[model samples]
Target chain A: MACVVLSLVGISAAPAAEMVRIPAGDYAPPLRAAGEPERVAVAAFLLDERPVTNADFLRFVTAQPKWRRSRIAPVFTDEAYLQHWAGDLELGPLAPPCAPVVRVSWFAARAYARWAGKRLATTAEWELAAAAGFTRADGKNDPELKHAVQQWIAWPVPAILPDAKRARPDFNGVRGLHGLVWEWVEDFSTAMVTGESRGDSGLDRDLFCGAGAVGSRDPGDYAAFMRLALRSSLTARHTTTSLGFRCARDVPEDSSP
Target chain B: MKATAWLCTVLFAAAAMAAPPPMEDCCKEAPPAGPVSARSIYQLDATFCSDTGQCLPLAALRGRPVVLAMFFASCGYACPRLVTDMQAIRGRLPAELRDRAAYVLVSFDPDRDTPAALADYRRQRALDGAWMLLRADSGAVAELAALLGVKYRREPSGNFAHSNLITILNPEGEIVHRREGLGGGLDEAAQAVVAVGKGK
Candidate 1:
């Protein structure tokens, strides 16, 4: 048994996954319902090198002083989260300013986008950009962003849906989508259906934490159920240490989704 | 000629004194929030202007007792109960003391709220004449809100993120007491009002 196990273990490391970068262009979700695929307009921007920092969001909050958090209407402070994210050094410069901001509500994120004079990227736009997949030769943040994205934009071949768990957003190209914080999508209602009451069923399940039925086997699936589900898990009604945002710009009329 | 000039001056001074500042029951000289900090007045400034442009400064409501609570006019369930509580409190007041106190309802929904909307909101509540529905253009709202230590936020579902706190202030602008949640009835709030008013 030992000899057999050792021989099986002799299998070499899996080769690095291929990355195919699709060019800057309009794209559609690889998975569609039985009928027509809804084509969303994809505007393009250079992705944030990483999830936005505390300083990035603080800039948004300070500029829109109207958005200053109020304790009475404290929507975003989950006792569980504050205990997890806050550091012990409250009054000092030792605090890490660039650590990702947490505990932001959806409204605040939208307000931040508006303040930035940009909008949150829609799921379709995000998927199209994410899909043209990338594989990193190495794993550094900046180079990873560039290299993985370059591989993603170059993806030429298609794989089956089940294989997509490892595939980048559009996997037709070698683009990378993993290892970053979850991105917010614009199609918020896909998680909700019409006529849902607070407890009846669907997205309005609970005020504090409800499931968004935008269910997906993989994050790459930007279907209505999956999109709705992503919106569901969020608790952003106030400033939390966990919440943050990124801005998406509109492509000139000449651009695509 | 000197006597005539002195008489004219006295008459002009009398007219100036007669034209008092706007709030009659209010305007007692009260100090800023001092050493005796109380919990009921947790979130203080009441600067949200109602649609009619009232700064709705709760601190301005010094001296004459105040029964202050927060409410959103659009609320489907909890709001009417809040009104009923205030009305019941008003019902308990002796007519003379009733005339001595004020009630202000500040809306957190500034985007859709207007002065006309506030007037309609007041009318719907059927609150007694002493209650004033107010709004402000963000700045005064923050000021008055901070004074009262009132906290609130807008939720993803378009409702407000708020706690239920009702405060009763003395004529001296001190928060004598507070009750948390919709459970505080008009009787409870009015009781606090009467207690503080009688002390003054």
Candidate 2:
């Protein structure tokens, strides 16, 4: 499967679409239940080469005016959603045109992805893709990558974003995944480190049969744990300065299956 | 000024004529009466298959207030009590008000919680006419879970670790209140249902 930039009507007006083809591979994520398979199979998919920029989102809102900040429903977003934008259509001085857009709620992100005929990457898929380093596809075992992620997590967020493509790309040709904004995963809500169901609730154990064994598989994987924690704490309507998202697409049948 | 006043009067009259009748009686099972609000959960275009083999958009339940929760049929731990808590809350409502409210249990395990499975679970739980056991496709499940703010993950073992939340939605499908955790007092939820049922 080849990843190429396709000019789509609803998503972007830019000359080149930024997408990368991720090959199908086996991923051993940090959060796994005991007795589960050691590796999970991830199907080949298309991912945005860089995070969605303010300009890209501007085009989306321009095409579908209902998604404009002023007109959006309260149910889909919190008060802070798109507050950084100077106006509904304007990116303002703080957000540069090429900077990754922030302060977008999960609902807004999902809608944007839908408008683009793409979908948000699942938590597993995001983790799998982010595991790549400069040289290797599966860098979960790389202490340097893990340390870099931790360092990024500790730093204060920059007031102004530089550019979506400023950071170097990873082995998969995906860029700015780690040292940039936290992404909105498709199944972010499913990161249930803490919620209504617990082993104490006998039925929850039955419902999530092996969940007792499903905690951090590698306690040393602090970066992964932090990401999981942040995701679970979020609501669909909540937005933040450090969170943004890119889009993904399943491989077409003729190309892969 | 005279023409503007006349126009205002005409517009007001049209709006009043278009207005739905006030739901004064908490017990009346009104048909879905108005356009769904932009914020309403019913805005989601998801189809749900009930235990009794009734397949319809979740919006079909818009005519009455609903108490909603998510669980899989085979959950061995907290789900049974979650159902009981739902039952307890429904029981606390006045009989007339009870008839106007719905108790909805949406299964997170759609693969196993088929219509047949949901039906069997409903039968075993002795759910009454006031209750609906529902299953949908995975995409619908994710959307509903996101809207409801209930987190869940299916383990490799086919069980789901889920958050326990009971959400109360008005007849318009707007979430009015939520009770979190396992097996808490249903008083708050019950009160919210009555208030919503009475169009408060």
Candidate 3:
């Protein structure tokens, strides 16, 4: 066990995980109340090229026993957290070391990011980064990117996941932003779609104070709507087999490597 | 030089593995005598500052039935009503349970609702010592809100759009009941607090 831990540490120290710069841009929130800004300005930031891998998480749990699957507090996560792993320190067959770590609650993900000296991307930043195409800044007009996103949504997740590092890079050289997994953002709770879609057009003012005069910017954008719906449906402690997350950081003024 | 660096990394990793789990800033206080319940919110290690500027862990509220809600002091619409509803629940409780219960309001706007601001809010609301107005950093506030299943967002206008929720916690810090969306649930919520307080 000691040798295994040492080797994993060695691997992580070999090269720091790649981070891609997402240039400053604007994010159009898919759904917003009437008085909300139409487009939110997002500053430039650094986002991890791929999601955190199982091996990386194994190292974290090995060092921080409180966060280990068996030791985590029930209030922080549901029963299914890291249920796929064989044991506290072992990934086993179901979760390949290189595969993106899944079944992580938002709190657990945030802790991992904090440990790594980074933070989860916000909804606006994540949306801005994911909006890029393979060849251009705007993915909305790119037929190929649109087709890939739609295709991925139509398919069910395979029993065993593939290597996260192998995903194709998008325009900003960031990979797995769309086709790999549903990522957790920093302010996911802010996506306030009421439980009943029928009442979403006009939010229930009683249940959610000041959720006034809400409307979708583009109802035809099924992907954005789906993301918003998924976010809204999740509680912070809830985790799923298909959900994972990547970290983001502020770009320093001098841009040191 | 490279080999030395690798050896240093190995030693650092070993030291980290051997050390106790990292504690949050608010966990410096001596922990409670025994293990908290697995499902208890007191298991959270984050600290919060009361309106009086005293820092304390959530565990400090243990052994007292607590009526808790998350609100921003500047909220114009639902927050005032939420406080009123809480007071009404306290009114409904049996006299013994009423004085024993703790009324807690945790702020969502950490940037705006400083300890002083929370103190001002206490004065404005005429909340007495039994009522605890608390504020913490954004990270700690977010974690507490997550545990309570409260969702809030700061709008561009600086007011918060939030879920109106009132939670009842037993002496052990486990949630016994939750009143969602305000108004009518006060009777049931009060009964829940009574039940938990009397150990029914």
Candidate 4:
């Protein structure tokens, strides 16, 4: 009986090192202005292995009353914020403790990252990490990974999400970079798309200054295009049913876990 | 003991009923010392530095109507036009309402636009005391831009590509009106300021 109790405690405490180290890499943005570089360099960083879960966010809202569903300011989130939860402090049938928390606004996600002593990954870092294949560093040439990603994109989200921990790990031992949910990056508002696909060839110059020179780099990368479209369409206070977030940290100087 | 308590309550009620209601103090400059409204931008806890190098919080502007925009000084296009548009809005307001409103400019390039730079820009633009030029750390600037629905990106050439928007905030620090795509809407923005100032 004592051994079983000890093992249970061990299971609960195992998340201490749940972050995976992503190596320094380069990310090519799908869209860029004429003067902007094609590839942006990303430094080494620590990314959470899975998305932040319902149980994890519950502890945050409970400890910080300002973030609770009933108490959060309207400026930080819309009315749909945390609409899936059973009550201010309860998770209903639709939400499972281990499932990635959804329906959270960008402001709420940013505040949670600050509380966790981490930050939302920049677009360059996130794209670089997500570019990896399951078995290789560059997923662009991996047919199997490409097929899996396309299939996931085609399917509709399930009514209730599966456990975030169940997602398969990729080359860098990170999970849920794709085929789970859309995420909030730190600079999502920088996407700058004009909403009309044809207008993207030369962004609406009147609406956005210096955007007249912007154009797409790769029309064949459907997945990256979709992510950019979603990001540009969003306002900071808006939340969707499938939108969630994970945290990232700068790798420590000493390199110790 | 019960009779004594009942007598005390009756005496207190009689005294309260005899007193007149408190007058509304129209000249009061400070906001009430309580929680801000749920939708107020003053709920943001970020601090900013004015052109004069004074540290100021968003809450400090709580009691006045604010006409705010985000821009950088070195931009050769759009930013100069945005400032001129703000000046137009200020001109449209009645002289009485003009003096009561605050025109604020926040910089997107925190790295380059220090307090000294902002002060120089103010002097060149000939902005009066009613105008405030402010800059903050990048994080605070990003948060404020996000709240105002402004999208901006720094170019390799050190210039910024940003949305052309000017926002009018009421005395409570809630966004009351927005003028998008520039060169027009100065009349409407001035009307909004007048409405908010008069309502207050």
Candidate 5:
């Protein structure tokens, strides 16, 4: 284990992971209607350089045995939580050490994030960070970025994902925001992009049923639309092979030390 | 104002100390007779402040069947109907059975729904007799909402758009039934409460 312990009084540190600082900024998200300001303001914070890897999660489960697949409360996770793993403490042979961890429920992800002295990124923070491409901080309008995201979305989820290192980093030096796995944002359930039960707006009520339906401000942002749709369908306990997560930390106050 | 300041003083003081015990340990003085079921909502470790300014562990209600709803005080639509739905369900129950069951409303807008706000809401609605409105920090609200499968979003107009869900939990804290949308569905929800009360 290459875990380093740096206990600076005011600085938060992680073991065996690289995190980069993301500066504060505002970006209009593409998921809304054409003219509405889908602008989300994200504050300065530290983000994991890559998604939490299988190896990283293995270490976490080892340390916090309460989250072991066998021991976890069903209220916190579904039956498939970490079912890909061979056992409570062992990974399947197909899971690579550096591949992003999959089959983690929101509760497990939240716990792991807490154990790492971090928290799951909020939706605004994640989107703001992900809006960056290799060259531009806000790539929502970059055709190349849009094309790359769409291409990744179209690819079938492989039985085993490749190393997180294989996914290219964005302008903010964060990796695996796309082209690896669908990340679990902290406020995913708040997406609320579904049909209104009271309002009869002639939407596809069948698909929107049992979801929080708020019309998108940018209907043309198909990628964000897909993300919101998927998010709206999920409960916190639901886990899937394509879903994983990364951790983030609030920038420590100067006086905290 | 004095009451608000006093409540804030008490709340912050409690927060400065250790987190209130997890739901399981909250009842250590008189622990639940058996192991908490894995599916019980009590598995979530959250602390909430009641409308009357009583700080409570979520598990404190473990022995009583609860009808819980998530709502905000300032909601212009849906929430008033949601509260009425709860009342309608309560009215459907036999008077004796109603006293045994607890009705809880947790706020989605904690920033605005202080204990005072909740108390005001309770008074305006004339809610009493095993009924309470509660507020917690934003993080706890999110976790409770997640456990209940309630979806909510804050809109630019300062109003909230959310799923209207009323959940019925057994005395052991397991969710027995849920009603979705505003108004109606009282019979099923009431029967759930009655059944859980008998089961306990």
Candidate 6:
């Protein structure tokens, strides 16, 4: 199943219309690694730049009846937390719903994506969309497109973001990955750097510096620290700033099946 | 001898009549070990000895009901508050259950809470016959505390560092639920016991 990045207006826009997709297998990894063979199809769309506003989330809450006045587990007990995420929002003449939403926990983000008939983009898939990489939707490579994209990334983020929806002609299509609010990704089980789960929860004693990734001494493996600290935080815990999410989809099974 | 025997019977009847209602809902775990029809508590088999009374093995409560908790008779703050909490929970139970359940308050301050002290504490709570303030040997108390995951450390200021919590055991000697912090909702706790008692 190809992940569709459609505009809320149902427009599939200019650069995207002209763009050809490279078949899923075209991009090669920089570093050879285990689990590389496992393919995770990712599809993401450009946002209107800022995180989705409170109004956008409110639409989601209203659509999904079960989310209203929810009885989330202990992690969601904080009343203030519930209100912040479930802010009062209605369509406004000037208010923007297409903007990104912030102050969202990884749990909350995952729930919202699931409710919306989509899945979160794994970090690799997200990187592929954001950074210079082969277009894996079709079996083709335009080196000119790849070079131009690399050059644009090398260019410092423009003082003004080129409209994310309108992919720059010099580069392939994607928007708001770098310098935007940190996006929550899937693969919660994988630490960012080492790609391993961390900590001593009863559920993961085997990975508790036991037999797994604990053997690494390089300081770059500090992703474990970030993962464990992130896990300790309550599910509903979120600051009203600087956190958001994008989504992905599994390629159609019939295509492979 | 017949008149004396009659007098002894009368006194025994009076004592039983005046017994305090048992403490219900002590030392329990929730999200029961198996299915979730209705029960919610973790249970344990414990033996509580009154400071001077014989050790009462929890097996006796199997087929009978009981409530259990922790305390140091010498505690000045939350410990006394816990007694009030447990008593409130007891008052809410049906009298039939009230008569069947045993309230076990095992003392953690063994160095100072002797059997005599426990008896005095029981009287203060007006336990009459409803509950027993137990005083196990220091070793026994430690062993009991460890099994329940209750921790207590005496502070220099005389106050104890301990959580105010309650445990509920079913009539079958299994813990059905637990409520932690001084913010326990006892009525909710009672429901936990009844659900377990009925084996739901």
Give the per-prediction TM-score of chain B. 0.71, 0.83, 0.82, 0.85, 0.82, 0.70
Q: Which tens-of-lDDT digit does each residue in B11-80 have in candidate 2?
A: 9999879856666643354566676887889877679999888899988998788999999999887788
Clashing pairs in 5: A32-A217, A32-A218, A33-A217, A33-A218, A194-A212, A194-A213, A195-A213
Q: What is candidate 6's fraction of native contacts?
A: 0.00
Candidate 5: where are CA atoms >4 Å away? A1-14, A30-36, A140-147, A195-213, A255-257, B1-31
Strongest candidate by lDDT: 3
Pitting candidate 3 against candidate 5, the one with the higher TM-score is: 3
Instruction: Itemize residue pairs with steric clashes in candidate 3.
Output: none
Better of 1 and 5 by lDDT: 5
Superior candidate under TM-score, 2 versus 6: 2
Error of 4 at A73 (Å): 1.7
Error of 5 at A94 (Å): 2.4
Could you give candidate 5's fraction of true interface contacts? 0.36
DockQ ranking, best first: 3, 4, 2, 5, 1, 6
Output the worst ten-in-a-row residue range by lDDT, candidate 3 chain B: B24-33
DockQ of the two-chain complex in candidate 6: 0.02
Scored on chain A only, each candidate's TM-score is 0.51, 0.85, 0.90, 0.89, 0.82, 0.50
**Which lDDT tens digits does candidate 4 get at residues A127-206?**
99999999999999988789888988998999799899999999999888889999999999888776222223335566
Tens-place lDDT per residue, model 6, A4-79, is: 4323322221111112221242222222223333333444332222233445455565654334335332232234
TM-score of 5: 0.82
Lowest lDDT 10-residue stretch of candidate 2 chain A: A1-10
TM-score of 4: 0.88
lDDT tens per residue, model 5, A1-257? 23433224113323466888888887555454223356867788888999999888888877777799999999999999888888997887867888999999998999888788899988778877887877787776677788789899999999988999778888888887878899998988766555432332323423222233434464666766677778767878889999999999998888231
State the lDDT of candidate 1 residue by residue for B1-200, as single tens digits.
99999999999999888966667433443434552232333234335555456564444665577777666777665556666666667779988787768876767666666777778887776655688776665434433443443444444456554444566777655667665455534567777888877734
Q: Give the TM-score of candidate 6.
A: 0.36
TM-score of each: 0.42, 0.81, 0.87, 0.88, 0.82, 0.36
lDDT of 3 by residue, A136-209 (tens): 98998989899999999998998788899999889999999888889999899888776322223335676778
